[model samples]
Target: MKVSTHTCPVCGFDQLKEAPRSKSGSASFEICPACGFQFGVSDDDDGLTYDEWREDWITRGMEWSSRGIKTPRGWKPEALLKSVLKKKK
Candidate 1:
């Protein structure tokens, strides 16, 4: 949900709203009011074109969804973060 009103490259439409993200923490869809173009946020984060942004989004998504589903990818990232954040008792 952390998004700015940026122009959609696909539709040359500047008006965009932050659509709800999926369980994977990726934007489920974007709607262009001018052209009625719809596209997913992942379509914008490919490594070849936007590697830095992709990494940034991934980090944010992981953090935001930490309390939600434990993605099928694995629990290592969440576990690692929890361990790192855990206080010594």
Candidate 2:
């Protein structure tokens, strides 16, 4: 068994203590306690993991909902245009 330790990027504190291996040996990630930050380590260009992105998006959505915030009309239009372009590809 190999022990993996991750230090918080923000606070430089070693708070999270876990070793999580991804499916198909894709990547690994750890959480930080001092700043509640999470990061992923992978043998690829993108440093973020799927879990990190999902969690971040979910958290952002929850925060936005709590604040009664709505996505801007301009942003929605841009997204719709991008979606149409992607579908056409």
Evaluate all candidate structures by whole-model CA lDDT and list the values in order: 0.40, 0.39
* Per-model TM values vs. the true structure: 0.29, 0.25
lDDT of 1 at 87: 29
Worst 10 residues of 1 by lDDT: 63-72
User: How many residue pairs clash in model 2?
Assistant: 0
Off by over 4 Å in 1: 1-3, 19-25, 41-89
Candidate of highest TM-score = 1
lDDT of 1 by residue, 1-89 (tens): 85566543332233346543445757546544433334453445432222343344345554323233233343343443333234221
Compute the lDDT for candidate 1: 0.40
